[model samples]
Target: MNRVYNFAAGPATLPLPVLQTMQAELLDFKGTGTSVMEMSHRGAVYTEVITRARESFKRLLNVPDNYKILFMQGGAIGQNAIIPLNLMGGARKTIDSVISGAWAVKTQAEAARYADAAPIIANSCDAAGRFVSFPEFTTWNRSADAAYINICTNETIHGVEWYPSDAEAAVVNASGAFLVADMSSHILSRPLNVANYGVIYGGAQKNIGPAGVTFVIVRDDLLDMQHPLCPAAFNWRNVADNDSMFNTPPTLSIYIAGLVFEWLESMGGVAAMAALNDAKAKLLYDFIDNSKLYRNDVQSKYRSCMNVPFFLNDESLNAAFLEQSAAAGLAALKGHKMVGGMRASIYNAMPIEGVRALVGFMGEFERQNGQAF
Candidate 1:
């Protein structure tokens, strides 16, 4: 069977060239006569892979010299606890979070266990109670001397994102706190200002590589603030001090991630990807906005470029839509259960051709089903 356009939120898709390169190198990586998976993490060959991966990430994001990029194991969920365990140990134990969607709620709930997790800054919903928009910066209610304020830059399930803005950094600075961002689903999809954040973390499954590794970029000052109870492996200071090799790292995933970084460089880096993503998002959103049979409830300004969730006008057609879309070579269009609808996750690896095909299919589905709705 031919490769289908994958719209799943995570472990989503990799660039074809990256996959092909991995296939070519799977048996004997860089003439080592052993697979990357089989090599020791401390070996010179594997060290080069991890170093290149880390350096490429820093270069692509333009990360500052004061921040350490450590490839740790644990999905974003695990960081919910890990973040507080590290940062909340200081005299300032308050963590303020803006409730954007489901993931933000979870991250704050976990932080509550370790710190004085304050009331949410603001909800994404408006007066009508639709999870379609984001709170304005002026509306934020922050705690005094809070250790850090958390925000998920992108909510994968609800298809909401905090669009790039300087207001977030301003708020953090004014509140006497650093910013901790969960950029799991949309980290590498656009250009970023790394200095504005104290820590930026995300899982590798979506835009980076596979499932085993999680990337954390932390400023130098935050490294030593971990609680004594924090495990050596989960401690950012220890992880950085040992150069992300305190324990065996995810060798294969790091290798593949390095290939992806190189691929992104060849494709003109994140700024170029951002342009392509905007075009793809425009194509899909424009179609949905003009369609009578489908609607995306997300507010125009806050809608995520990486994930688009839309509902059919007639709910009864959802099963048929999913079935037919899959049979037509589109996969994982089902929305998260918390929100019942169809979601198309177009991450970095997904091509514009795939988005065009999806728009074509959606148009056909709308045409055939419009009379009923």
Candidate 2:
């Protein structure tokens, strides 16, 4: 029972209760005399599981009735191209993107392959070329004839989060274009207004479940705009029509996600999770801000609550810090190579005690290494 606190970005940490429940039923789920993985996806028992999962997810997120939740494969990376293929055939045939960090850039690049013109509406880079702050809403140069405006709500690598402001909401509302968000890393960590976006999607590995399932919540009206080249499985309209069984959906992963939804509900849903997440993020961010040996690059207003990327003041100490942290029962403290620093991803499954442990370790490490740096 010696479990270390895991902080990997995806395929990260899941709630222990959910994991235990799964372990309890792994061999024979619900008296069916078979594991969930062995059951037929189209069978009555499996159908009940998927239906409950979708319903629980909808209830937790308060998803609008008009939105269809499709469980598809390919994660967010696959959605990058699929989104453009499905939505770019609109009359405008253009995609307006807000470049915040790595994922947004990838999505925009993929969209460009299908869009008539994919333009950068806003970029969150400073004059020094660091992706630290989000560009103001007024500074966004949106296309007059864009099919959809794309934005990554949270950048997992660069550690920036896009919190919707009144002005930003007003701007999007007036644009008459569908708002598309890549909410992969921070999807259910906070409460979201599902009505605000035409499409919201993410990979389940981050905070929901395993890596096999990707969830797409699309508005009904937007489903009919797929390009002629869109694949039957990747097409949102077709997937929705087939109830996300256009291909064999991620059966086992979806089953785990269903348990997570139930766990969230028992913990008071997204609102409660948001409050706890705020506390966890604040604890770590405040510690880093006050420490002389560590520093976080992203601007205060744009900091990601889920993924907090920080660097040691002395580059030479990076390896030592990682080694010591792992020895001390902290795992996956290494940052993405794109942003070479230490990243602590404290997702919903991370309790405040974990963040407190991290902060305590940071303080001790600084105490020993501060004078030298």
Candidate 3:
């Protein structure tokens, strides 16, 4: 059987080893003669699955003991509301958002409902509404007493990412506000100093496993500040007390994510993964930079390692390029509707060979269509 290279943004491609493990355990997981999907979440078998998943996640990310890893049902969009609900109970009800792209803009809008949401709009977008760079750290006016400052670490649609450095950390710490990041698109692709952020959350679909669960890592101290209306299940403090089993939980997805965590460990963990991710991003970006036909608009310093959004110089060939790419075993090359052109979401599961193949296809398409205008 032939497997095409998949580049969907969410419910994205998963590591082959994880998929193989799932297949092996499907009929009778761990010799129990029951598929994980059919088994009870409360049973010892599934309990082990979740426990192992959490511990492996902790180890892989080097999470501090003070952090609680919660397997949740809501996606990032859910967290937009849940974040304010859980964190705005403090006397400081305001939530400051650092907007870089569409997701961050939406985050600010959602936070506005539950708290004093203020956005530090990035000067990163060009006059034509194109993202060309990231806002300078010094330019951000983060709220000093806000409950937390929300930022999307990587803007998938705009192909902009924040790779925090020592200088940036100092700026972030000086704000005297809790740092919360939505690392949905690039969570496991690199190593993050979990100490730098109050909350680190992402949907598991991109790098962990399939959809259905969003894994969250929240500092223990931040758990208690939930609004009065916050649901018991959505409250970090309550979810922590219940061990993420307050509800049925996403059993099959958790089980699969556990396999993925183990797989990441076997492949030398996040540090090694970061190195590979760097090489993959560089290979693709180098090609795009050299090709007059294709160009990535995001500033080089802030370009995403996971999602690379590029446009062909000749817009007329967009549909045909996608059609030809699909025929060549490349799927989901279409960019988000908000950003016209093509986006290649090369997540952890997307091997280097996939990017290489994609570059080859782009080259061939360019040659056939006409020279770069």
Candidate 4:
């Protein structure tokens, strides 16, 4: 009955309360005598689930009335093509991408397939192909008639985050382009002012629930711009018109996400979650900063609260570190292969005690390894 503190980047840990709720309703959901997964998506039971989930999400994020929350099937990668396909109809053929890391780079490449031109506005990688920091907003070369400007608000692999600032908003607004963000890693970790961007899309696996469900909140005005060739299923307008039911939705994933939304609400919603996440990030980052053996490369101002990527000063200790951490009940501390280090993803389900335990384990590991931390 032991549960390790899981830190996988996505399809990551979920709240125990949410899991319990799902278990309780697994066989019979609200007197229906059937699992939500066993029901028809078009049935009344499913309708209630979708409605409550959307409304809970709206309340939690304070999403505006002008935005439509579409529970989609494809992950953020799907949105990369779907976004341009839907939004590039009337605007110029060019799409501007601000590349911050691997995810953003992948997004730009995907956008190229849909748009006539996909221009890199700013690429943050250095000659060694390391993502150290975000390019300054002033340094970007935006297109005059660009269909939209795309940015990954938090680069999960590189561990960079962009807090919405007036300068950033002004820059996007001045270009007369819709601001689209891939917020996959840090979607529900904090409060977002939805009006600041035209579209915000993220896979639910990280901060929300299980895989197979993605959420896209698009401003209403951006719906009608889809190209004639856009697939009916991928078209935002069609998805919206059908209320994200054009095809059979991901029922189990959506239902689990609804349970998570309810769990979040019971725990005092996103504002409270943001405060908790801030404390958790600080706990881990401060330990990394002060430790002589471990180092975090991301610039302090842009470091992600959800994903903290750090490297051991002695690269030889990587395997031992992971093994000992696993033995101590800390799981998935391995960093992405592109970045050879350790990454601790402290998502919503990661309690403060988990971070404290990890810090303690790191200290013990350094001492046993004869390194001063």
How well is each residue in 1-373 modelled by candidate 1, as lDDT tens digits?
A: 4899999999898999999999998899889899999989998998899999999999999999999999999889998889998987788988888888889889989988888656687777656545787677678787787898888889888898885367769767776798899999999898999988999999999999989999999999999888889988999988998889999888888889899999999999999999999999999999999988889998788999999999998999999999999999999999989888899999999999999999999899888887888
- Models 1 onward score TM values of 0.97, 0.98, 0.97, 0.97
Q: Model 1 off-target regions past 4 Å? A: 126-130
Which candidate model has the greater TM-score, 2 or 3? 2
Off by over 4 Å in 2: none
Local distance difference test values of all predictions, in order: 0.89, 0.90, 0.86, 0.90
Model 1 shows how many backbone clashes?
0
Global local distance difference test of model 2: 0.90
Compose the digit string of candidate 2's lDDT tens values, residues 1-373. 9999999998999999999999999998999999999999999999999999999999988998999999999999999988888886678798999999888899999988999899999998777666887777678898888788889999999899986665666678687886889999998898888888889998999989989999999999999888899998899988999888988999999999999999999999999999999999999999899888999988898999999999998999999999999999999999999889899999999989999999999999999886787
Residue-level lDDT of model 3, residues 1-373, one tens digit each, is 6899998888899899888888888898889998999988998888888999999999998999999999998888898888889988888877787778888888888999998656553446678987767677777776667777778889988889985566676676676677788999988788888888888887888888889999889999889888899998888887888889998899888988889999999999999999999999999999999987898988888999999999988898899999999999999999989888999999998999999999999988888877546
Could you tell me which residue pairs clash in candidate 3? none
Residue pair clashes in candidate 1: none
Error of 3 at 198 (Å): 0.5
- Using lDDT as the measure, what is the rank order of every candidate, best first? 2, 4, 1, 3
Full-model lDDT, candidate 1: 0.89
Measured with C-alpha atoms, the lDDT of residue 208 in candidate 3 is 87
Stretches > 4 Å off in candidate 4: 371-373
Clashes of each: 0, 0, 0, 0
